[model samples]
Target: MARMCAERVIELDYSCNGARIRLVRESGQDDARHREAVPAVAAPVVVQDRPPADDDAGAQSLPQIIEITAQMAGQFYITPAPGEPPFVTAGDEVAEGAPLYIMEVMKMLNRMEAEFACRIIAVLCENGAGVEIGTPLFRVERTDHA
Candidate 1:
């Protein structure tokens, strides 16, 4: 008797701002468990003198940019626990109440659930990375039904 093996090659490109990739080998899994962590980079703050006192009609409302922002500062996690499969991935249609991500703060895991059905448009955060408050973690499209 002889054993047959499969050949595979996986490439991870971490060519984004504040991102790191981690790969895991698993048995019977076609793709590797790819984990990523990204942190919010602080932007340089610029203060400007109050707009000419007579040239303002108050701040105008602009179209809003919807994004899933982190509530607190902590590391982001895709799976419920280490070595477990992720809750969702890009292009995965998730229904309301679906577990989307986890936030680990002070060693405590907080599960983040979806509010509405949507398709994962992009994963904005990296696994095992620190995210500041109000950082976009995921970008999803709100679908009629998922």
Candidate 2:
């Protein structure tokens, strides 16, 4: 008996700063063909102006908010399993290496952990929502920074 092979196709489209980008991939395609389909361009570097330092007695320091993005496109989950409480919620302080969320890709669950201690300011994505690569999942303030 002989077995037959099936081809797979995947497409992703998104917009950034009014520029729309699209990606399409089909199984069994050569590297040259894939490269021709998508051209690479250098990303722009943004420089932000820093606030002037106050020499006076009443200087206010603001907490720096950081946005955590998805490393890969997948289904985002807050809990490890169905009916379970989330690993972390807004206003929760998470230590370094603590599990923050999970991404389900190709039937495999990938646990996302914090690289540094942080306070969860907000959960940006809904549980069980499909997210693309570079999608913002959470907004957190670094607690380890002084």
Candidate 3:
């Protein structure tokens, strides 16, 4: 087997027969100490020498829909407690500092929030669903409701 190693999470991307795959292999313990991968525009980007599309609706939409991902690995939760109301649901207006939801990773509760004022367009994950580092939990549409 061909070995591909990196200090941190190594993202290997490729396309096969119209199927696209992005393999995100978690780094070793030592690797996490030196380099840290902070979630900042983690969306896939096709970098080309030429300038991007001028009227790029696709490009614009990429940044608008925020991705609440797992920092480590664990089940995702929408409510603070079981049988409790969810923080936000689809079509709900969310503020910048409002709590979007929680991602329980590594036995830790990671509370995710809206980067900016946005409305929850889609809830990609079901309640109590398992998630990895790059897994998308929710997709929010940036709205002017802050």
C-alpha lDDT of all candidate models, in order: 0.63, 0.72, 0.65
Candidate 1 residues 1-146, lDDT tens each? 01222323234345456677643333344444543343333221112223323323332222112367777778889888789888998889888778888887667777778776767777877777798777787777666421
For candidate 2, lDDT tens digit of each residue in 43-92? 11112124434643332355557788877777899999999999999999
**Each prediction's TM-score against the native?**
0.53, 0.61, 0.54
Among these predictions, the greatest TM-score belongs to 2
All candidates in order of lDDT, best leading: 2, 3, 1
Residue 22, model 2: Cα distance from true site in angstroms = 24
Worst 10 residues of 1 by lDDT: 41-50
lDDT value, candidate 2, whole model: 0.72
lDDT, residue 50, model 1: 31
Off by over 4 Å in 2: 1-60
Q: In candidate 3, which residue ranges exceed 4 Å CA deviation?
A: 1-67, 144-146
Candidate 2 lDDT for residue 31: 46
Q: What does the lDDT read for residue 110 in candidate 2?
A: 80
